[model samples]
Target: MRRRAIPLLVAAVALAAAALTAPAATADEGAAPAATATDAAAPAAGADDRHRPRLYTPAANPEAYSQALDLARAGLYRDAAGILAMVRTPQAVWFGDQSPAEVEREARQVVRDAAGATVVFSLYNVPGRDCSGYSGGGANTTAEYQAWIDAVARGIGRSEAIVILETDSLALIPSDCGQDDAQGTKTAARYAEVNYAIDRLEPLKGTKVYLDTGHAAWHGPASITPRLVKGGIAKATGFFTNVSNYQTDSANSWFGKLVSACVAYVGEGGDAAQCPHQSWPREQADAWIAANVRTPSYQWKHFVTDSSRNGQGPWVPPPGKYTDPQDWCNPPNRGLGARPTLNTGDPLHDARLWIKISGESDGLCLRGTPGPEDPERGMVDPKAGDWFREQALELVRLANPPILPGS
Candidate 1:
């Protein structure tokens, strides 16, 4: 599912106005966002890659920038600066539900905005997306989806772009969500659709397409590896995890390494079931990788992780509070995670991204309750892709790296 906002001009104008009214820097304020001590000290995973692309920061959501102005007017300069800093950070621009012509035009405009920097694109609108859940709705047919993807490719022309092919397309297939037929027609179509997308987008000289592998918490590396292979991982740059989910960076990185190793092992005639998963002891898993997986780091499938809202890690529900906790849906107290960076300092890991637009609602979360209001928050959450002001404020206040410099 993808979050959206009002038209581009309105958001641009609102963000500009808010930027003008934001308080001038004080002695305590720093010029740019300051990385936490933990981040500054973390080992470089892929520091050898001296040519990693620069990331592009797209325009902010209208409501979010407007909220910054509102806070500034209310004499909360720290919060206002935090919000401004957050929106100014680099993030993805999603494309979906638009006609091929519309998408092509919009994609071209985004490339133009980026100039020469690399832009991250979250392409939703796959048919049967979300299995008709809260953020459902996609192209009506397979042909329509192919046409849409083709348009996106044409829009990029030859510019640099990292296409996060489709979130949840592999992790939660039609069969997993019970949306498949007895003969599995929809599931097969889903694979073909993903393959088609990879074939279409990955060939562009300036484009690198990545498949979806859910998150570290959902599917184990061994379980998702076979699916990635079937979905044409051999053709894609690699796969991404933790899109729109709250999982720790360490967890995601380990999961990615395991999955890459498993893919290589399976490719070398080993069974995916026999590979080490995230649950295995780290010492044992590392030992296994050393002994069995012989693929070079450059040859192995690289991965990107979403760090938009995992600053506080994941939320824990009170002991057996609800039948379906829906922990993934709008869990409270989640803060913003690491800032997007290509120089992640890991060989297997590519980058840490903010794939899910921070501050957007994750639909109406009931948490298995019967009330119209969310039991945890005492009010109904906004619709799936709408702006969530309360959650936005919470994210800025609790941001792990600390959105403000000295806060």
Candidate 2:
């Protein structure tokens, strides 16, 4: 029965067909080029003038954008925008393995393209990234990683941007992931590298740096807060949660608040060991916050969450289905979460529930299988960073806010 279910799911995805890759008129053909930094630097057209977060549409994703235009031209306006919307919002552009010169040039280009609007840049070249897992490959040494981060900082050059530092750098540590001391000592070096990044990037005139904390599902507030503090959350604007993972906004938000409160509590001479965990009831948590967290929400460390692919929340593996579920990997039936916005009502929650991880990319799933193909899906998923058309279409189809005509 389980084997039969896999084929059906794959068939449904297959229906998207060439539409996923169809070419259409250029974006400039129907739409004007995005405003330049000079134009964006000018005074507001209205009293409510503010710098809009710039969505850096990658040239690599022309197929997705072109397909959306085709859909719109075919009068499928909602469908078209649903697909195009991902590109229209701010998503993190990762910098890894590139030289100081190369990363700086690329970073400047993105900031210049934003024309002074806030753009998200993800720094992902930690010393031992991904714990030597499928997404492995980072800087070979601490000195190399620091130099890379310094280059990234120089690239921004006081431009307005939010730097999402090192996803999984803190969440997956050497102790847990069995990372080697190939360079004599990597675990300690990882923490030092993150701190170095914060030191370099946080002082930039217009930058906001947020370190990554795995997700609500993985690390509890109690366990993750100390890690954040040690990783230099005090110097950063705050920390980020749920980067590239599927966890609900509610869960992520709550978890973030708890972490924020913990940071504040510890900062004010309180103990993190005594702070309330996410497992506690809402009333109890609130009471704990009121009693212990004396600082105002604004004064506390704020956090942002990645709501990229969590509309249906985390995947629940079928009972006894596989030896290793790898639930965090590419799971079936996941949907897009909230659109990016700066106006989160909660003060502790920062602007932009961003697509920290691009939805177009595949999460290589092994699922305890010995072979290359995922046993559950019965297919070899695309390597990380490769476009996954089936998953992209699924995200559009299952968007929670319902990617509609006006929405």
What TM-score does each of the candidates earn? 0.89, 0.83
Model 2 weakest 10-residue run by lDDT: 23-32
- lDDT string for model 1 (1-407, tens) is 12342243244434444554443221112112221111222234545423435677777777886787667657675676677667766788899889999999999988887767678899999999998899899999999999999999989889988899889999989999888889999989999999999999998989888999999889997789899988999999999999999999999999999999999988888889989979999999999999998777679999999999999998888988899899999899999887777767898787788889899999999999896888999999999999999898889889887765555
Q: Which candidate ranks first by TM-score, i.e. highest?
A: 1
Residue-by-residue lDDT tens digits, candidate 2, 1-407: 23654354233323332234432112211111333211112233453445443344333365565555455556565566556555544466778868888998998888877666667788878877888777788888888888888889888988887788888999888767766556536667778889999999999999999987899988887788888888998899999999888989999889998999999998898778898888899899999899888888889898888877888899999898788898887788888776665556778887545544545555678777686887767788888876666677678778775443223
Best of the candidates, lDDT: 1
Quote model 1's TM-score: 0.89
For each candidate, the alpha-carbon lDDT, in order, equals 0.82, 0.72
Scored against the true structure, residue 38 in model 2 reaches a CA lDDT of: 17
| Number of colliding residue pairs in each model | 6, 1
Please list the residue runs of candidate 2 whose C-alpha ends up more than 4 Å from where it truly belongs after superposition.
1-60, 63-81, 180-184
